[model samples]
Target: MGKLVTVGEAGEAVVLERLLAALAVPASVSGVEAPLLGPGDDAAVVVAPDARVVATTDLLVEGRDFRTDWSSGADVGAKAVAQNLADVAAMGAVPTGLLLTVGAPSDTPLAWLEDLGRGVAAACSVWSTSVIGGDLSGASELLVSITALGDLQGRAPVCRSGARPGDVLALAGSVGRSAAGLALLLAGGPELAEEVAPELLAAHRRPVPPVGAGPAAAAAGATAMLDVSDGLGVDGARLAAASRVHLDVDADWEDQHVLDLLVAARRLGGDDDPWGYGLVRSWVRGGGEDHALLATFPAGVAARGLPEPFVRIGEVLPVRSGWPAVTVNGDDEVVGGWDVYA
Candidate 1:
């Protein structure tokens, strides 16, 4: 890895090639070969194996999506890539390339930017994807926009509208840890040394989405699928509404993991009543940002038939009268999850 040149050391004349070279070298070393043309060209040309493409975009702002006090520049960059790539995965496609854009103030350190590039390269390498091209510009606050492309490989794109009655609701990865981490940070819990809290704190800093589970579910004949970016209650409701079916979730509150988180929450001394069942349930059921995959498979598919890391948690039901989109433990209704406008 090349040593990052700081802004103070580089002076006023910002050479675009120097910055791009710093990024491109690591990308090249990571086995990121351009399908047609990579950086240093007007544009990149990527091959689509199935004559179709799955694309999605997401933006992350400094103050709103992240904070330097809590997260390093590399964490932000990796997270930005992971979220966008997960969207592509949700469509049952293989991630191929990414186009990243960074906007920052003049005072932003070049070293920080270099670390961000390394983060991006690292994430791309994980999925065997490529950072084809991107643009950089000046802005008021640090902003990152990522556009990801994927190949379907002749499989139909899995959507959220295909779930039906009798389908088995399953989850690919764990949840609630990110929200708990956020709560800990907000309550200054990280400042206090503790055993289990650091894991939660790491989750908030960088989430690991189930990048391969989406395609696995699709291959296993998943009827409907979506990533749990928002809270499970909110995103589950959206899936239910889209499929016009109801989800009856029976979260295992007695699970060991849930119990551990509850203990951590209480130790953090947050404003919320961590000991109460309602608050704990809120974190497990309504807390978001984990980016786990919630999918529905056909009824006949047994546990062994499904992919690894996927566990059954609920079932699909007919929309009954006076019932909300999603119900917890057969009675408790979840009205909403995270709301940006709220």
Candidate 2:
């Protein structure tokens, strides 16, 4: 470990000082109302033209949530933004602005910071959202926090608890690939990794959230919807509880090719419990960071823009008086997900 240094509290520009300098000011945009002493002030006041405000935040820390060696600064920035933005989308809202905070050591490369900024800018541009403001500070490890604001356009906000019995469980993106990529990274199987595609690793490192599916699902008569952040199994359980319905995931129901790829990745990694690592089982139940769209629709309603292989993994059962267990292949199983407090 490196020696710890504490510059006197008297040092003019302490850790927090340089960080603010790096962040500078928010990007220029119109209709944002007057700054009215933003950021560095005691507090900030801004007008919300819409009576409703959609808000979500995510935090990324070095080594725990990400690694510098595995992901570039840009990747980190993009991932951070994507996760929070996805949350807004889950509520069936459109992201309008982001407030980001970054913490890094003084010796961190300037290029890295520039790349991080570029990453944030690129992601914001993709969704047509702007970085309204943020904070910067020095820390022992790199940490990125982003809060996204969204607008619902007077539509009802879709939540997890609205599903009724007989609703159809639907998904909008591929699962297990991110977990598979992580497995390949751990095994260091360059040959097999190539087949998985280095970009797939980006899915784990910097996930491409399904930005369009949220509103589409809502418009398509989705009774309930959520972004699949935690593994499918665990998040599904959450929906089941909120909606007071039992969710049964037919792992056997997924496409053969997708299952085969997951099995192959597991073999390459030599993991005895392939399902536990967020691919077969956990991803089926416990995977996280996918940001895929999972929604429950009223029977007979057609979902729009649902791409190929967007399978109906499960269905909502009536609110029964029993433990909310996810049944897989005829056996009830525990929901696979990380213990945040752990």
Number of clashing pairs per prediction, in order: 0, 8
Q: Which 10 residues in a row give candidate 2 its minimum summed lDDT? A: 1-10
lDDT of 1 by residue, 1-342 (tens): 244355445543453554565455454566665657676688988989899999999998888889877788888888888889889888888888888888877778787777787777677777778777888877899898999999888899999999999999988876787888887777665574235578777777778889998888888888998988887888999899999999998756325337757755676544666464555566777777778888999888844567867888889999887788888778888654755656
What are the lDDT figures for the candidates, one per model?
A: 0.78, 0.68
- The candidate 1 region of ten consecutive residues with least summed lDDT is 1-10
Tens digits of lDDT, candidate 2, 1-342: 023243223132443444334333345533333333455665554445568998998888888788787778888888888889889888878887788887877666655665677777677766666566787677788889999887776778899999887777778776666766666666664445656566667677778887767766666667888888877777777888888787766655554425644654555534665543344544445557868878888777744434333457777776556655456544567466776567
RMSD to true structure for each model, in Å: 2.9, 5.2
Error of 1 at 288 (Å): 1.7
